[model samples]
Target chain A: MYRAQVRVRYFEKKAYDLFLQNLVKGTSHLAIGQEAIAAGVAAALRPDDYVFATYRGHAHAILRGAPMAAVLAELLGRQSGLMAGKGGSMHLTYAAGNFLGSYAIVGAHLTIANGAAWSARYRGTDQVAVAFFGDGATNIGAFHEALNLAATWKLPVLFICENNLYMEYTPIATVTAVARPAADRASAYGLAPIVVDGNDADAVYEVALAAVARARSGEGPSLVEAVTYRHGGHSRADPGKYRPDEEVAEWLAKDPLPRYRERLLASGANPAVLDRIEAEAHDEVEQASLAAQGAPLADPAELERQVFADGGATWRR
Target chain B: MATLTQVATRTVTYREAVALGLAQEMGRDPTVVLIGEDVAAAGGVFKATAGLLERFGPERVRDTPISEQAILGAAMGAAMTGLRPVAELMFADFLSVAHDIVANQVAKARYMTNGQLSVPLVVRFGNGAGLRFGAQHSQSVESWLMAVPGLKVVVPSTPADVVGLLAAAVRDDDPVMFLEEKALYPMNGEVPSGEHVDQLGVARVRRHGKDATIVSLGTMVHRSLEAAAQLATEGVECEVVDLRSLVPLDVTTVAASVTKTGRMFTVEENPRLCGWGAELASIIGEECFYDLDAPVRRITSPHVPVPAAGSLEDAMLPSAERVADVVRRALG
Candidate 1:
């Protein structure tokens, strides 16, 4: 879990640098401080379990065992990326890894996740699907509709809301009516909603593991609201001036990586082991960045190939 | 070379033909599932899915809540993961609620996934504006959907065409919008029995003539045929073409007819500002400019919401007489 968090930090930093250099075009939403939830939730799931996440989902894809090189190549719009450069940062789907999709549209991913779970129930499979979104998505109509459908059908779905306290620049309190969004709506949908400190990766994994078991055992859906914070602005463009400096400092002190390192050290873990783990993650990310830098751009001639599967696409004269 | 083929046929309403087509596809393919409001026990609002729930059971035929976004979103997700889902929106006007899912998710997912994913999903909705169902319930929004690149739109006019085109839509490996004209559901015609799949993007020449060509789709096809018959009495031999498929439009067939007749008339139930009639007129002008003796003409609904009053609604929509008048103008 510590290695996963550190790798995400280093990977996103390089991505930000690449964006500054204009190597990576378009905006990217980075999950710098919210790595613990991604690592912990992913660790709790089986290999075949499906994951549908929001646009800020690089860490989720990486923790789900997507190759870093391909992910970096995707951000660089290279042909060898996860989506063959067609989907940049916002839209990524790793079919083999069971990372169904990372959609930019808020609350849209929830319905698709519910459908995956519904399909699983229809096919009589034990597979469970999870949808990861932010606090802002909870207020969307589709989110409530998905919850209602999942509860009524007893679908094997896990709704994960990483409540970072803010939706873009505005605080959750400003936009939402309820104080605890997920918990307040849980009873209306007749599903158990669990809230946890997202900074503590261990607590998140424990709760998520129990939820996964419940879903696989046909106990229906559950909502897990992990209270975390985003250390950066919504996108790379914003400077995060809207947030109070004191609040930012307080959250920075509660950074998950160093806290996890302290927990590992106090448990009498070898100091060299932690050092080597951190060094290896840095090396891996460095190698991935170099590989992505050398990757080739997508071919323009086949731009219309994937538009339709049957290959009947016609260009207008 | 010439060939003769014979197939068994029976007369049925457009509703029965559509329902039969769905049932046959469901029986043939296990992955095909029906999802919509009142599609299961109630058998759909228009009864287009009548008797399907009893045959397929509740598992395949699901009656979802009145949520268009969820319906379309779930269909997209299910289709991505090996299920060929045929979802229904109660009304074509309600497509606005499922707009993002249909346009952003369903249409773009295949291309965004770089061929790694295929959304073999079909969304069926009732279109056209002659029902006096008001502006919200009635609309011919095919032109709005055609602007979207990844979607294949089909407008079947007759009972036989509905059965054949719907079967083909379910089997097609892409997102297809099957727009059914609400007024034509009770209209009766002969449909071929057993398994039948019509080739999409192929326009059929309904009536052969020599003076002018009349291109139309959905309800307008019948109106064009009627107009052609009326023109025939006045020594104006008009060729009528039924465009069953809208996306991969059969420009070649329309061009051939226009070249032969040297005049063209395109009709649609949608408004004239930016309707499918304008597209047909442009295609004909671009492809058969030199072959045409006169400029192509378009007969379309007025640029206003369909009125609730029956008389006003009748006046707004294009009819056989209006189409014939346009043909006469094109000939002159």
Candidate 2:
């Protein structure tokens, strides 16, 4: 838990701050206030459970299982990065941990989540797949297609909408007729819809646990919408000007990392032990960034490789 | 060691031949699945996957909603996860609708994953004009896909070619864009039974003649073969090579044929400019230069949208007469 909390604590300081610090190679989208949702939902999942995320997936990749360094290395486009520099910030994969992938397309990952869940069901594994997207993605055609298919197929997918209030600079209110919360879309597909306080780690965790359990037990897919915030710009430029400053301050006050830390303290976690864990996670992130920077890249001639199959897995030709 | 007539090869329509290939693959591997709109009950628009849903249940033969993007996205998802998914986009023209997933996702997933992920997916569809689907539907965008780096573009003209290529695409690890000729579906040829695999990126010499080479693909291959037969009566023997895959282009066979024949007449149904024939012409000029006795002539459609009238459609396609005329010009 302390390991996860390092990113959590740093995120509360400022999303833009971490975005700046995590300047690997390209533009970065920091979750800032959105960190709680990953920590929250991640708390409810087993290490073997699968996760598929979107562009704003730094926190998800970290919380799911990828070391901060590897992700940072990936972001930096270093050869030693998670995707071996192939997938920058937008795409990341951890197959061994069942972290399916982090897609940049708005609502693309949900269908993949359905496929993964369907596979899990076919294999007779009790593992549940979670698809994380944003409120903006709710309006995309694929989101509707995925939900309708999942509901009909009864696949074990826990669709999580990180309602960060905006798709880029456009607020959900303007872009989506988010009649109720995004969770209400689930009812149209005959899936149970649940809304949670995304900032509260424990709150999100409990809902995720129940939803994932029901899904794995053949109860079918569920949709959970976590109402959260992104205190930083959507990408590298904007200061999140669309949302009012007062609303930002109000959410910052409810920052869950500190709140969750206080809860852990009150629940008997040692203060000195917490400090040691923070130091370790900090050091780990620094080391990963260095390692990724030093990793080797694909051969340039192979630049033209893998557009087609040379037969099987080998991209050498 | 003569391989005897133990296994009688069966002749089937280009449509049923592909259907047979997919069905055979599905029968052999439980993981091979098919998904598309009306592919289940309607048996595909051209009856390509006819009776497949009945043979394999809806779980294996899926009918996707009218969303082309969804069909491709789901197939990409299924391929990366575990299953070997073959998605049919009813018409090649509809590729524009799902351009994002195909251009960015399916094509780049493997390279982007740096070999960590594999999208063993096949997108099967029909292209080329002549049925009067009008401008919206009648598009031969083979060159567009051929330009994409990671995609393997296979345009099989006959039943046997479709059967063999479909089986190979189902088994290939990379994304295979398998294209069938919209005009040649009813054409029949012999196809082997059970898991038959046709090698990708190799041109098949349909006819062996020395006077000139007629390079063609899909329906044009049939046209070229017909032209060769007609030209035979005129004392002109034309060799025809059916290009199986466009991207991995069997340039070796093409170059060899161009080298042997000296004169070449390439035929195509797409607009004359930037068509696959234009590329093939350019390649022959570059590689098979010194051997050419005369300038390589090409039979192609005029640069315009496919007209609604049947007369115009007939004229737009590279007819046997047109191919024979071009071959005669090249032979001179």
Candidate 3:
């Protein structure tokens, strides 16, 4: 899990460097400080279990088994990208890994996740599906509707809300009605809610495992509100100066990478092993960046292709 | 005319035809399921999905919550994962609340996914205005979906066309917006009984003439035919074309008719500004400019929401009289 977290962090760092160099064309939402949730939650699911995530989904895609080279190539807008440079950073889908896709619109994937879970139930499969969204999505109508439908139909879905306390520039507390938005709303839909320190990978893994088990057993749906923080701006432009420095400093002290690193060392694990894992993660990210740079740009002819599965045969009169 | 009247033995109402198409497709493919609000116990507001619940059971026929977003979003996900879902909205006006799912997700999934995913979902809704259900319930929002690239907008005017087009939509691998004319739901007409299917992009020439070409779709197609019949008495000889599918617009048939007739008049139930009629008129102007003896004419509703009173709605909607007037002016 620590290795996965480090790999995500390293990938984001390289992506940030590429963005600075103007090689990465579009806007990317980095999961730098929030890597633990991706590493932990993804570790709990089986290969066949479907997964959905928000715009900040690089870590989720990587942890769900998307090749790092392809992911980086996607961010760089290359033909070798996961979506052949069409989706860019905001939308990434790896069907082979059962990572359905990610959505740029807030709260859009909740019902989609419910539908996937419903599909599994309809097909008589034991596979459960997970929807990873943000605290901001809880206020959207689709979120409420998804919970209601999931509970009413008893679908096998796990709703994971990454409570980073900020919906873009506005603090979530200012807009949200309750202290814990996801948990408070889960009760209205008759769903048992679980709250955990999202910065801790082990705790998130334990909670996610239980939720996945409950879903697999046909115990309806569950919501897990993970309280965490983002280390960077919402997108690539903003510096997140709106946040108070003292608060930022406080959260920085709880950075999951160093926190886990210290924990591993205090448990009497060899320092050389941790150093090697970190070095390997850095090398893997560096190699992925080099490969992405060498990848070819998407052909212009690709623009007219795949508008519809039938190539819009019926579309052209 | 004598043989045409005899061929009406297997006639059914427009609503029945739509139901038959859905039932037949569901019977043919186990993956086909109906999901919508009140589609199960209530049998839908216009009864377009009548008897489907009992015929297919609750597993295949589902009643979703009163959430358009969830309805379409779930349909998109289900389609990607292997189910051919026919999601219904109570009215076309409700599309405003769920346009994101249609425009962004369902429409762009296959293209954006680079062919890794195919959204074989159908969104069926009650379109156009005649019943005085007011602005919110009564609307012809088909123009809104025409701009979306990956979606196939199908508007069926007749019973035979409805069943055939709907079956084709269900079988297609792309997302389709099956817009059913609310006003024409009760009208009865003959439908081919066994294995009836209409190609998505083909246009049916209702009446062949040489003076002028009259193009329309949905309820407007019947109104255009009525106008054509009236114009025939005056020696105007108007050619009538029913464009069943909007996106896969059969401009070829319409162009051929315009080339023969030397005039074109497009009618639509939606507003004049940027409506489907405007698209047809512009395409005709671009492709068949030299063939026209006069400027292409467009007859459409005024740019306003459907009013509550029947009198106001009558004024807002296009009529056969209006189509006849436009055709006469174009012929001159």
Candidate 4:
């Protein structure tokens, strides 16, 4: 869990640097401070368990076993990218890893996750599907519909809301009706209200494990609100001037990476082991960035490829 | 070789054929499942999916809430993973509510994934203006879906084509929007015994002629055929063609007919602006410019929302009289 969280932090930082250098084209939503939710949930999931993520999904995809280099390549629009540069930074998909695709449109993938779970149940398999979205998604119609359908059908799925206190640039609390957007609505769907400390890896992992176990055991779905914060702005365009300096300082002080490191140290973990893990993560992300930068751009001729199953975008013969 | 006389046929309504088509595919492939609002116990609002619940049981023929987004999204997810799900959007206009899932997600899933994922699913909906259901319930949305790249749009005009095209849509490794004309549900036609699977992007010539060619789709096909029959009495010798699928459009067939007849007219139920007929007219103008004796014409509904009144609704749709009048005037 610590290694995964460290790797995510390094990868996100590298992505930020690459964006500054104009290597990673287009916009990217970074999960710099919300690494623990991804790492912790990833720790509890099996490789075959399906994960549907939002556009801010680099952390989840990487933690779910997508190679950092390939993810960076996708962001860099390289031929060696995850989708051969067809789907850019926002739509990263690694189906083989069961990390479904990251949906750019908000609140759409929630219902899609239910479909995946419905399929698993229909096929009589123990596999579970999990969807990760923000607190803002809870207010969307798709979110409510997905919860209602999943609850009524008793589908084997998990709805994890990464309540990062903000929806894009606006503070979510101001726009939201309920204090706890996702958890507060859990009762409406006949689900237990589960809110976890998103900064704590162990706390998230415990909650995720319980949810996964319940889903796999055919006990129906769970809605978990992981209270986390985003360290950066919504995207590369904004400076996040909307957030007050005091709130930023308070959250930065409670940064999951350093907090986890201190937790590990206090739990009697060897300092050398921790140091090596941190160093390896940094080196790995640097190597990935270098590899992505060196990769060639996707061929222009391949633009029309894969638009249909016949390997062509031919609409008329 | 088996002769045409050796094959047995049974008459069935378009509504019955919808269920028959679904049952055929579900019976053949275990991966095929049906999900829609009131599709299970209620057997669908139009009863187009009647007997599906009893035949396939509750597991395969599942009923969903009035959530179009969830229906399409779930079907897309199932299709990507493993199942070949057939999701119904109830009314064609309701597609607006779930347009993101259709246009952005299901349609682009395979393209975005670069062939890593393919959504082999069919979204069948009741389409066209009729039954006095007002603007929301009645709409010929083929043009709406045809504009999207990754989707295959199919509008079957007859009972037999319904079974055949539905099978084809279910088997195709892409997202197909199967638009069943609500007005043609009770219309009956002979369906041959055994499995029926039709190829996509193929147009069938309902009547062969020499003077002019009449191209149509869905409910308009019947209207065009009626117009052609009326024209035949006046020595017009008009040919009628039914374009089964729009995405994989059968332009070759239409072009050949236009080349032979030296005139082409498209009769459409969709409103005038950017209807499927407009695209066909442009393609015919480009492909058969020299072969054409007269400029291509499109006989379509005027640009207005379908009215609720029976007389106004009838007037809004392109009737046989309107198609015949348009073709007769253009040919002169």
Q: What tens digits encode model 1's per-residue C-alpha lDDT throughout A1-317?
A: 88888888888998898999999888899998898898889889988888999999899888878889999999998988888888889887788888888999899888888888888777778999999999999999989888888888788999999998889888887888888877778888887668999998998999899989999999999999999999999988888899999999999998988998999999998989999988999999999999988989976755787888765356221
Predicted complex 2: CAPRI docking category? acceptable
lDDT of 4 by residue, B161-263 (tens): 9988999999999999999999999999988788888888899899999999999998889989999999989889988999988989999999999999999
- Candidate 3 residues lying further than 4 Å off, grouped into runs, are A312-314, B1-9
lDDT of 3 at B178: 95
> Comparing 1 and 3 by DockQ, which wins?
3
In candidate 1, position A313 carries an lDDT of: 58
Error of 2 at B216 (Å): 1.0
> Which candidate, 1 or 4, would have the higher DockQ against the true structure?
4
| Candidate 3: residue B315 Cα off by (Å) | 1.6
Clashes of 3: 0
TM-score of 3: 0.97
Q: Where does candidate 3 chain A have its weakest 10-residue lDDT segment?
A: A308-317
Q: Candidates' DockQ values?
A: 0.59, 0.43, 0.69, 0.86
Per-candidate interface C-alpha RMSD?
2.0, 3.4, 1.5, 0.7
Off by over 4 Å in 2: A8-23, A179-181, A293-302, A305-317, B1-7, B193-195
Q: Give the number of the best model, judged by TM-score.
A: 4
Candidate 4 lDDT at A268 equals: 100
Per-residue lDDT of model 3, residues B289-323, tens digit only: 99988988889999898899989999888899988
Fnat, 2 decimals, each candidate: 0.49, 0.41, 0.68, 0.78
Q: Compared with the true structure, what per-residue lDDT tens digits does model 2 show for residues A1-317?
A: 43575664453233344446764446667777776678877888888788899987777877777766677667766556777677787888777677778888888888878777776776568888899998888998889888888887788889899987877888777866655447778789987678999888788888988998899789898899998887677887677777788988998887766777788899999988877877776666666655655666534554554444552333211
> CA shift at A21, candidate 1, in angstroms?
2.0
TM of chain B, each: 0.97, 0.95, 0.96, 0.98
Off by over 4 Å in 4: B1-6
Expressed as tens digits, the lDDT of each residue in A111-199 for candidate 3 is 88888888888878988989999999999998998889889889899999999989998899999999897998888999876899999
